[model samples]
Each structure stands twice: as C-alpha cells, then as structure tokens.
Target: MAEAAWGNGELARAVNRTGTETGQRLKYDASAVSHWLSGTSPAAKALPVVLETLARRLKRPITAFEAGFREMPTPVDKSTDTVSGLIDLGSLDMDPSRRGILTAGLYSVALTIPGWPDVVGRFERLRTDPHLRIGMAEVRAVAAMTERISTLVDQFGGRMARPMAASFLVNTIVPYLRANADEDARKAMLSAAADHCYLTGYMAADERHDSLAQRYYLKALELAGHAGDHLMYCTTLRGMSVQAVNLGHGSTALRFAEAASSASPQAGPRMRAFLTGQQAHALAQTGDKAGALLHLRTAEVAMDQAESKAKAGGRYDPSSLAYHVAQVNYELGDREGAIRAIQHSEKVRPMVYRGTRVRHRSMLAEWQIEAGRLEEAVQNWHLALDDYLAIQSGRADDRFRSMLSATRPHRRNPHVRELLERARPMAGGRGSARTAQGAMT
Candidate 1:
C-alpha cells in the first residue's frame, strides 16, 4: 500500500472494481484493507483481484508472495479440473471489462510442463449434463469454429476475434464437453476442444498475455491427452515453445520444443518441419549457433519433403520456415541475413495473412533502418501501415510503437517525417492494443 501510495479506501475500491469486472461480487472496503494490513489474508478468490489491483497501480506484475500472500505451489497451480478451469478462464477472457487484468499476467519462465504420461488418461470427473448429448456433428462444428478463428487471427489479429473464441468456449464448447456422447464422439470433441484451446492460447500470446496463453496451452495438453491425440499433444507443446521463444525465455522454449519432438513418435514430414523449425528458433535464442543451424537445415529438408507431397493446412510452411530462418539469423547477429530471410517470408506469405504481414514488414523496416538503409525502411514501413490500418492486433500495435520509437531520431528526414505525420492519427485513434489471447489438432 505504501509503495503504491494508496490509502486503505482507495486500495479496497480498486480491488473491488477488479473483482466486479471479473464477475466476483466483492464488497471490500477500508475496514477490510485494515484487516489485511494487520496480517489477515484475503479470501482465496479475492487474492487475484487484490494483486491485480496493485499490479495496475505499480505498472508491474505482482505475485502473491510479493503481495504478502502465500505463493502457489507452482507458477500455475493446477488444482481444478481442466474443463472447469477452461470455463472460468474463458468467462473472464470474454468479459470486456476484465481484459486489462488478464493481459497484465506475467510470463512464467518456470512453468511446470506436464509430460505425456503425466496428462494421458488423467481426466478429472466432469459433471456431465445428463440432458445434453453431442456427436460428430457437434465435434465438426467446434473444429470449424476453431478454423474460422484461426483465419480471423491470420487476417485481422487476435484482439477482435479472441473474445468471440472465449465466448464460444464457455457458451458452447464446455457444454459439449459435458454432453453425453459415444466414445468416438467424445474423443473427437476432446480433440476439437484441444485444438481450440491451442489456438486460443496462441492468440493470447500474440497479444502478449503470456501467462494466460500458458494456461490455455496447458489445458490444450490436458484435453489432447484425454482424447488420446498424441499429435495434438505435441502440437500444443510446440505452441507453448513458440510462446516462450517469442517472449525471450530461451531455455523454456527449447524445453517445450524438444518435449514436443520427443513425444511424437509418429510425426510425419510436415509435423517434423513444424517441430524442428521451432527447435531451430529456440536453439538460436539459447546461443547454440551450430545446433541451431543444424536444426534449421533439418527443418528445411522436412519442409521440402512435406511440400513435395502437396500437403496443406498445417501451420508450418515455406513462409513459416523462412521466418524461423530469419529468427535464427537475427539471434546469431546476422542482421543482413535476417533481413533477407524475413523478406522472403513476406514475399511467399499468403495474402490472407494480413496480420503477419503487418508485423513482419514492420520488423523488416526496423532492420533496414538499423542497417542504414533509411529509404528502403521507409518504404516498407509505409507498406506495413497499409495493412496495419485494417488489423486489431497487439503485436501489430507493438510494431507500430517500435516504428515510432526507432524513427524519432531520423525525424528530420522528409520520408521519416512524412511517415510520422501519416501515423499520427493512427496512434491517436488505435484501440486498446495494450495486450493480450487460439486451434490446431
């Protein structure tokens, strides 16, 4: 309270506000704050609200231990059933009023990842809706909805699409999970749900909500295990690796990537490419230049084999492979090589991936500026802006902010000045891209 410079009443009101926004009917007041200050712990449910309130004021993540509450046994405590946990998480994510708190979660580098055996066949007893029944049709519906969400993320970014995904997860998918079904249908639904959760987690990471992404990713693992979907289990692990790598947690990312590869005994060519590409990126981030290059070559070979088979629909492709190459080059201090690889990524990237275009192109511009190619950088920035205008993504917003910061020193240049002037209104009118929210199975 003293660090945050908040009075007892103010702290209580802030906690109360966060609680209410997240669907809790909290009635904390100054008296309650006084009691807490006198060594009385808040209720279990209210602890998050209190911590989030303090984090907001302090402009950093506030862990339970730091806030004088007992820390969870693990970074992410898994005390509840997976299905129920998903429902709660989805409910909070869908509520517009709760976005800030969810987005503010700290990425847990020490996240305890469940191994294949740990999660396999370990389902909590779900409360089935005796009156409800689901079948393959409902399973297909869920898969289709997940695919649609993926497309939306590819095009417009995660911000606009994630709330809908969360609402669907809570209002539709959970009920289906609880609905009576044949074994085949039940397994199929579980796989579909796992895919949806993975995609939702990816979106959460895209928006920079690392902790929320890990939660969804972990649930995806649990669901995949229950479904006996080894492929999806591995895919979710790779997704977690992607989240960790993007957030600069190199060892954690490599752990997830390696775990994904090690668990998938039946992985095909495309799967190999997907897994290895991420491994290369993680290895690069961890400063394993030789190992990273070796993995990168292996990924390229696998991608070639997969494309020869005319496979489609998998997330990893030539464009994504090039991205890994770019990431590897950049990590190893090969800025020029990174620039070339990323440009290839942009060239071969499909038109439907408008959000990625914005991010990658903007990144390309940043590299160009660093290499003293201001003219080329300015042009790419303009192209990035062309796509940026249509998307609602936190990552894209990050790129926009980066552009402003990077170009400020060169503002005297006419091209840079013109770009800044063009971006002025966008910076002013942009949505709350302040943060963070994903499917594949």
Candidate 2:
C-alpha cells in the first residue's frame, strides 16, 4: 500500500519532510520503509506523519490502524478533553484495583520524546472561554490545596496522599476550570490545575505507577500550554524525565531534561540547577562519565547562584540537589562518593521530607552492602525498615525488596535470618520470603 503511493526512496523523503514540518527530525530511509512494510512500527512521533504523508499522496486520509499498525485507544483531543480526561484519570487512580490495572499498562518513552517541541508551539494558539466566570480567590484556593498536598506527600509518602490529591482535582478544581471566567482568571485557573496535575503525577511516580505517572504528566503539560505557563511546562517535562530515568530509558530521559532546560532559558537559578542535575544523572546512566561530571559541576554553580539570590525553602530545596548528586555518583560507580552525598542529603533534608529520608537511608544501606560493610548495611537497613513499616510507599517497598535480594546469600546467618523473617510480612502480596528469595535469584 505504501509503495503504491510512492517509490520506496520517495516515501522515505516524504515521511521525513512531514516529520520536519512538525519539528521532528526523522531520518527514514528505503530500508526503513521496507521494515515498515514488514510490520515494524515507526517512531511514535513519526507514525502520524507517515500516515499523513501517505494520505497526501493518495489524496485521502490514512489511518495507522488501517495499515496493520497496533490498535491504540484514540487519544483525547487536547482542545476538549483536557479537563474531563484528567478527572477520569484521577478517579481511576484513586481505585486500588483500577490503579493496579492502569499501572500495568504499557509505557514507552518514545511517545513523550517528540511531543515536547509541539507542546511549546501550541502555547500561542490557546483560546480563552469567556463564559467561564472565575476569580483570584478560587485560583488561590486551588494553589493552596496543591501546596498542602505536596507537603502531605513529602511526609506520608504518596500511597495515601495520591488519592486525596486526585479527588481535589476532580471535585474542586475541574469545576472551577469549567466555570465562566475572563482571560486572566481562566489562565490562572489553568496554571493552578497544571500545578496540581504535576503534583499528582509526581506522587504516582513515587508509588511506582509509571504508566499513570506518564499520563498525568502529559495532561499537566497540556494544561500548562493552555495557561501559557512556560515554567510549569518545564517542570512537568522534568518530572517526565525523572520517571523515564527511573525506568532505565537514559537517552530518552536526557532528551526530556535537555528540552526542559532549553525551553526555559530564562528560568531562575534554582530551576536551572534542578534541571541540570537531572541531566547529569541521565548522562551518567548513558555511560558518559565526563559529560555527567561536567553537568554536575554546572549544577553546583547554579545552586550557589540560587542560594546567593534568595533564602532557602522556596521552589528549589538544597536537599534535592544533594540527592541528585548522590544519584549521579551512584550511577558512575562511585560508592564512597555516593555515600557521602547521601549523608549530606540526610543532614540537610527537612523534617517533613519523611519519605525522601527513608529512601535516602535505604540507598545508603545499599551502598554499604556494595562496599562490603555488612554490619553497617544491616544497621542502616534496620532504620530503613522502621520507616518502611510506618510509611505506605511502593518505592520504599521496592527498595526493601532489593535489600532482601542482596542479603539472601547471608540469610543463613542468625542476624540475617532474623531480619528476613521480620521483612517477610512487609513484602505485601509479593508472597512469602521463599518466593521473594527465588524471584531475586
């Protein structure tokens, strides 16, 4: 069917041209065309363009599903479904069984990679609905709720807080967004909604629900564009980058981090530092030791500048900077360096950052295990386990699982055996200790 519309070489050029028009730099060739004909899926960003190119040649619309491409649910039209779609997503996220199903959905960083530029381009095209009446009081209320939920997530972890945050979005914020408002009020409301969406997305990621996290982040980005809030857009992109790196897509993560930095060149020092630190971590994951270190240094400089200009406890926190440093060092195989950085993070972390503290302690113990200091590792793990038992967090559970896997070899020892028994019940539906032990190996 593709060959009937154009010669093989011509098809590749046409697809590439279409992609370029959409701000995507695609390099499809004759071989790529042959691969596509044999049922290979094109890059996510290129797929629509490939179809559109074919449609142009055939003088009709060509749908991917008609060409034997895998069937995917039709995406929500950004123009209409932004609010209601978010509400539905929030409702689904709040249901334990439905949340699990959503989490099990497939994830692909490619789908997000090519959309960054397009998001920025759409900002200028946003239109305001004059019928929706809203004011500063309502916007302030949403912002205040967002801040409170963020604090709650920091202290209690996202397991309990995610649902509450989602509920607020569905019950309170969405209605205000849909209410009659002038241009300024509408933009402010949209920005507030975007911030809330980003927070929900972050909490979802903390709980290891990557698929839901991706959807929330995309929705946040769409809201930000409509609100003409470039900073929020950059923040949402950074969140996506963090999730991507956590899932081991370093190259895609780097693209997201870089895009965030590039799209907001006028961002404050603290924002720049955070974005650069994320880039360093992604580069470390990709095995670019020198590049990672260079970015790390750049991030440090940015942090110093931020501190010089403003007091702490604003948008950016110093503890987060240290955590990113620890992550970069760990990825670079610097166990000692990673340990020191995490220790610094622990010292500087605010009291309300309980979940973050637990995660850092867990990481510290893992590094100790790698360093052959089993006694110290055991001590740290005990502290981590106390927090894990108290907090409801899937990420904490994941760390505990990793710890159990690492300690399995020594479980025959009295101390290790006792710890294993203590950890078994906490594994939560991951099955018995024996099952976990077998799965680890």
lDDT of 2: 0.78
Candidate 2 lDDT tens digits, 283-398: 99999999999998988998999888746446556778888899899999998989899989889877777787777798898898889888788888888877776666767767
Candidate 1 regions exceeding 4 Å error are: 1-79, 310-313, 432-441
Q: Highest TM-score among the candidates is held by which one?
A: 1
lDDT of each: 0.86, 0.78
Clashing pairs in 1: 199-438, 199-439, 200-438, 203-437, 204-437
Q: Model 1, 110-200: lDDT tens per residue?
A: 5678888988877655598899999999999999999999999998888778899999999999999989999899989999999999999
Per-candidate alpha-carbon RMSD to the true structure: 8.0, 8.8
**TM-score per candidate:** 0.82, 0.78
Q: What is residue 28's positional error in candidate 1, in angstroms?
A: 26
> lDDT value for candidate 1?
0.86
Candidate 2's C-alpha runs over 4 A off are: 1-80, 95-101, 113-132, 429-441
